[model samples]
Target: MTAARANTGIRRAPVQRRSRERVQRILDAASELIVEDGLTALSTRTIAERARVPVASLYQYFADKDEILLALVKRDTAEMDAAVDAAVGALSTVSVRTMVAATMRAFLTIYHQRPAFVVIWWRGRSNQVVYDFCRAHNKRIAADLFAFAQAMGMAQDGTVQGVVELAVEVGDRVFQLAFEHDLRGDELVIAEGIELVIGYLERHATPAGIAGVSVQGQDGPA
Candidate 1:
């Protein structure tokens, strides 16, 4: 996928510093608009105007509004996974509860930081395209977790990946429920979600030495 995502069809990679700055500006403006007006209100022209860039400039990097939104979603998810990778990797050893708690805290932190993403992801689920992108993101998170689990000495049995994927799907739903009525997320639901994930993984994950995705250059854990 391109930095903006394959689904986004970003026109260029923004190799230059100026281009990168402009791209960030566009994303920031889109975020503000989304937070204020919701996804249904997005358009290249409006984003450009809000960003104070030409519409042509916005299209230079993003194909359309969905692309812009997907890029924003991508940034937030990357940070979320990176946070999890750092949190667990810093530990000398990881218990199931510790790992699950780290993952939940990492994601919740990102969700709170990116209110626009919270709006788009939770409130915009009725939009099929947005939902598809998010589902893909969930699968990616599952894949990353699978790698991390293997590194952590969880058995390499065939069931591990499948189990991890299922766990991620369930966790994603629980997170959605937590954020459904409250953008900051319901504290009770958040706490229960942690317990639920830890409980499921307790039977599945075995403790071992800590490792991080950043160290493995791309195939590492989350």
Candidate 2:
């Protein structure tokens, strides 16, 4: 069956377990197709066929191909957010270097686990919705980093937020380069990215004075 919904490209939120699973299968099929054949080969009919569901069932969840892609973007971004939050939370206190390493490692792990992320990120540059989502995601990450820096007494007087934004921007560029050269990511480039972020943070986020203590000198405060 052809998509009967309007061209607005909205998704019908699944409320039941079976429905959610079906929606997931549809998204999985789309992701696999995108990775195997590129975005140009993705279509609602192909996704439905791959998912072993009827075209109508696919429409029940996604209005069209774009809707399906948007849903995938949201799901992937949520997973990334969870990973980053877990990595940040694992550290009771953090230095600039430790924070950079932890966050980069978390992201690289996700990129490795979810190959679809590479497609989504690359497409984000040309897709307005995906682009906006990425920008928002970066802001949230920066905000989280800012809070972590404050908690660790490493935020500079007026540069914590900007520093965090720069770190995110630079990390994104380097990671993109790494993935461009090697799907899983280039180990050498990933290491360089970590160092690049650490250096930038060091320049902007000075250790907050606390008597014979240094944020950069230790893993964290004793």
Candidate 3:
């Protein structure tokens, strides 16, 4: 997806360097507020105050608090996606176990770096637009991972979309629970999540079908 398409929150895109800096400040202030005071306390006026800009300045970029929060959500999602993409790209050969570890680590790293992400994500779910955006984003990532598996000759010529989607769902739930219990994420839970994903992939993703070999049914590898 295009950058313009991915960023769906801002009222207007910043063009000049000064305008961009102001927008960044607004977003930074919003993030800090969410981290410090929780999502309930976030407001455009407060964000403007923290950002050292007028409320009008904030309105120039974001339509409302929800918009700012959505922008933050998109920003954090993009960073996490970039990290995962980079990690996956570096793998010359794909092993389900290795991919699971790399993806889990990459996600954890982002959570550590941006604790506010937890707050934004939790709050964003309440908004329909944000929820739909997140769902679409997840689907896109799953498709990309499926393509990666195909490129590595790991996935057979069949529909494994559900497998990738399941991986994402499992990862999100497990990671969210980890963060809910501990800021750094629970090590035991993360390890178990990795195993869960690897086991699922091993059972679902089969080698490319050849003349002599029969592909496994949905029940599992035969």
Candidate 4:
């Protein structure tokens, strides 16, 4: 009877810990593989081997390679969305120049956050699922940029239609460049791009004064 007193509260078995570890291992291996070989290089068997797990176990956690890729893309997209949201929040009570700078910082932040994925995105041969998602994401950003420019009174191309189209193009290119190339920490490069865009917007908005965001190269007389 005294020996029967030994007891303990409920506790998760070690199997649960091992299962979680396996899942994490799979994700880590997949991420490394992706960085080394790009998005097109992923496969369930390959990931299983890299993760040192049974191939069947990989399927236990993920339905397929596409599912894993989808998860990664979703994480990256969420990060970009959050970055832009924060940038816009900072501009809620700031000047246009400040907002522009914040926007540039946000773009660069997202660009450099996942260099490998960005490289894959720039390679231009990703799966259609990823490509379609990217197109939709860019469309949203372009619309936001257009609205922001108009709200700031800095986007006028003699008509709303013209400015809207130009804004969309400019917004797309700005982000595309930020992620497609090595421009991180290069303030001059980033500033020059921002200045070029601002100059275009200013020229269209007001024909009288020099309304561009002044930069080192473009400040000199024409």
Candidate 5:
């Protein structure tokens, strides 16, 4: 190939990186705005202003408002997924109680770490795109937990629905407590929530189980 031809075929690395960063900036601004004022207040114009990019440029990256919101949901969920995956990996072997506590802690940490994102995610806005993505993403996360429960032989019915339900219970309550009540001051609330979940799981979990299954430390003894 001629030098010009070779150059044309090669990707311009910086351009791609810059494009991604710009898109991220827009998404970040949208998330922050929606969290502060709710989805009804989110608009491309507002996002552009907050991101300091032209409104037209926001469209260049996202086709419309729905796309932007969907992107924000996916971004927040991906971060939570990564953290949960890391915590799960660390448990190489664990008891039902420990697994339950760890799962609850990982999830609570995700929201606690980004309370705004959690608020936006659960805001139940009227955007169908955001609604659908959140539904699917939640199923995927639950599926992962289900698979883990099965692999560890903790699911009595060979189905993870029970563990998944318990985890969601812990998550929903904690989310409410954190955002709706100002329970952030009451660290015991987080611990107690974990205990409630661990109690349910332990009643059903078999002891011929993985390592670290037994509860320990401040969060356990369930």
Candidate 6:
């Protein structure tokens, strides 16, 4: 990695760090362009211009704009997954309510933290690759939640997997709604979403007879 282009503030790169830094610049440039002018503003030319990389160079890494959007989606979701996993993994006393709220909070935090993701995910979700990745993200979260449920002996029924999957589907839409009208996300909608997911889970709660199943959490309360 050499230095950023003086005025444009874009770093220019291919050694190992060089490749990594160039990728970051591309991602960052795409992010800025998207946020500044919506998806319509995104093009390899624009991204390279903003990133200070040549159009030819941008092609070497990403074949098209959709690929760049997908990259941003993947990059942001990885962080979101980490936050949700840590929240669920750290739940010392997991219940449907606590677990749901903690999960919602952690998941929502990502929207606030990554403006680029919030924009790309909502805007680019219709793209085939991004849509597929989004589905995978939902399943991954559901799987993580189900793993915790399994440790709690709530995994007795095959229905548990289905129920958790449903919760994820519902949560994804509700959260999207929360961000729909406002980029910052409407607080009222977020709270309602938390309550809605918890209530939905509570209705399908595994019988208390299975409550004694011991499970140790990662580090903190969810």
Global lDDT for candidate 6? 0.74
lDDT to native, each model:
0.75, 0.73, 0.74, 0.58, 0.62, 0.74
lDDT string, candidate 5, 21-130, tens digits:
88878877887886678767778899999999998777676656666666666666777777776676666456766566666677667776665566555555465556
Q: Which candidate leads the pack in lDDT?
A: 1
> CA lDDT of 87 in candidate 6?
76
Give candidate 3's total backbone clashes.
0
The true-structure Cα RMSD of candidate 2 reads 5.1
Model 3 global lDDT (CA atoms, 0 to 1): 0.74
TM-score of each: 0.84, 0.85, 0.86, 0.63, 0.75, 0.84
Q: Stretches of candidate 6 above 4 Å error?
A: 1-15, 155-158, 207-222
Clashes of each: 0, 0, 0, 0, 5, 0
Model 6 clashing-pair count: 0
Question: For model 1, how does the per-residue alpha-carbon lDDT over 34-66 read when each residue is reduced to its tens digit?
Answer: 888877888889999999999988888987787
Tens digits of lDDT, candidate 3, 52-163 = 9999888888878877877887888888888886675555445666667778788788888887787666433566666777778778877877766665566666756877
Q: By TM-score, is 5 or 6 better?
A: 6
- Cα RMSDs, all models: 4.4, 5.1, 6.7, 12.9, 8.8, 6.9
Which digits, one per residue and each the tens of the lDDT, describe model 2 over residues 1-222?
Answer: 123332233467788899988988988898898878777777899999999999998877777777777677777877877777677557655667767787889888878777777876854466666666677778888887787567666776776486688789899999888888566788998898899888877877665422212334333211
Report the candidate with higher lDDT, 1 versus 4.
1
Task: Summarize candidate 4's per-residue lDDT along 130-204 as a digit string, tens digits.
Answer: 566666666666566556555544555554645545654575566556545452534555677777665565555
Better TM-score candidate (1, 2): 2
Task: Give the CA lDDT, 0 to 100, for residue 186 in model 4.
Answer: 48
Pairs clashing within candidate 2 = none
Clashing pairs in 4: none
